[model samples]
Target chain A: MTERKREILASSQSVLKEKGYAATSVRDIAKALEMEPASLYSHFKNKEDILKITCFDMADKFELAVREVNDIYFNAEEKLRLAIKLHVEILTQNLDSAIIFIRDWRNLTGTALEQFLTKRNAYEKGFREIVQTGIDEGVFNETDKKFAALTILSSVNWIVEWYKVDGKLNAEQIADKLSNFILSGLKKEMI
Target chain B: MTERKREILASSQSVLKEKGYAATSVRDIAKALEMEPASLYSHFKNKEDILKITCFDMADKFELAVREVNDIYFNAEEKLRLAIKLHVEILTQNLDSAIIFIRDWRNLTGTALEQFLTKRNAYEKGFREIVQTGIDEGVFNETDKKFAALTILSSVNWIVEWYKVDGKLNAEQIADKLSNFILSGLKKEMI
Candidate 1:
């Protein structure tokens, strides 16, 4: 995307995060950018178009992050630690887009919604597999892998809701502390 | 509240969950109940009134649950277990109100919003105190009490997003598995 289009997407994300998807309009995006609504129309088809792009972009980031960790030669424990760090970094650095991705994706309709859910489920499946690998390798305890993945993801995904740029703990600190807390539950008992 | 008023509140919560606070109208709630908007006006001054009540009522449920747990003689570990079960039960049993309480509370304005957040913070603080008690008793590991509390709350609270009434796990099952996972993380190293 061009610099101007990137700017529009950023502003649109901010407005969507504030007013929410159903209530936000193209005009609201335009107003946030101090541009004409017609100008925004020329750049993007409509509000849903912007939302689709935003949600898909976030999904792509998560997919890429996990794929990178998967390609590495780390064990399940290390892979999960890196995954948690990457997830927290993406959410904290892209707060507006993260919030919209989490809260406003329900607003997408038609093929967009279907595809979004598919991508999301696939992403979750990838995360669950990591937990499964840990159990298979006799590193993590044997438990419900689906429940474990969801527990880990939900714990980290929720950081977008309460993360502050100026908070006491930065993204790395949160990722470290949270990873320890979650991994403690998943790891096998020490003899 | 009268039976009629209670019915209105229930229907209003469903509408709010579907269309969101910004997009929902008083007419929508009336239509959901097959009543006229004029009739809704008799019970609710406006849409915000219904929202305020829904949010506060959910808060009251949580406060009561924690207060009951706090009044009991259970140790910190058992107290935390009961708290998790009660929290999950409230969310699953009252899914609509839980969703509205978690997501739509942001739409509240002025004094209502302030009071809602204050109550919410207090609730979080109470949860943290339980973790602190465990740490004080050396039952839980020495870690950031605030972070540990938020992690536990976030894991369970996110259940509202994916909980299925007919899903594989019932509320009690989820509460059991989630409590086990979270407590494992919080508990100190067992010799």
Candidate 2:
């Protein structure tokens, strides 16, 4: 995408986050970009198209961030912490896109929705594998791997719903707090 | 609510869950109950009113379920375990209402929105205090109480999203799985 198109999506995210996808129209996205509706249409077909791109962009970011856990040193614990930190940063730093990513995802249609779900399931699998591997290495407790993964993902994914840019905890602070809380649960200790 | 009114609301929940708040109309709700739209409007001013009631009914159920944890003996760990179990039961048992509770919450307006948030915060406080007490009792690990509460709540509150009625794990099974996983995280042991 060109710099101008990226600017348009960013502006559209602001409107979508505030008014929501159900209420937002193509004209609204164009208005936010200060471009004529025809010009915006030239760049994208419609509001849903812009939303699809915006949601998928965040998905790609999530896929990229979670994959970075592979690069961390051999400690599953450290890898888990870094994964949480980077994931939280991606959402917090791109706050508007993050909000749109959750709220407008339901509005995606047909192949767009399927594509989103496919990427999402793949992203979740990547995240779950980290937890699964932790358990396999005996670094984490012997618990239901899928449930543990769901709990970890749910706790972090939920932050997108309530996180504020100027909230009490910064992204790094929340990341540490959450990772500690989750890692504590997963660590295998001698009885 | 009258028996007939309660029945109408229950029927509305099904339509709302399928079509969502924006798309599900008074006609859709009325048709689900085999009533005329005019009669449905008598019971509910519009789709939003039915939505408000649906969301709050689930909220009330959640509040009642959490309050039951207090009735158990004062083992903080037991209380926390039972809390997760009961919370999960309320959500999964009233599965449709729980779905609407999360998805359609944003559609609530004015006094209904304020009332819902007020009840929700109080309900969260109820759940948090259990974690807070567990931490003080040393049954749970020393962690940021609020962070602990959020993580605990996130793990259980999230059950509403993915739980399937026909899924392999029954309510009791999920409860045991989640509570065990969470309690393990909070148990104080040698590092």
User: Which digits, one per residue and each the tens of the lDDT, describe model 1 over residues B43-159?
Assistant: 887778988999999998998898788779788999999999999999999999999998888888899999999888888887988888898899999987777888899999989
Compute fnat per model.
0.73, 0.56
**Candidate 1 backbone collisions, by pair:** none
Residue A2 C-alpha lDDT in model 2: 90
lDDT of 1 at A120: 90
Q: Kindly report the docking quality category of candidate 1.
A: medium
Listed per model in order, the count of residue pairs whose N, CA or C atoms clash below 3 Å is: 0, 1
Candidate 2 stretches with Cα past 4 Å from truth are: A25-39, A71-73, B30-39, B71-73
Off by over 4 Å in 1: none
Error of 2 at B133 (Å): 1.1
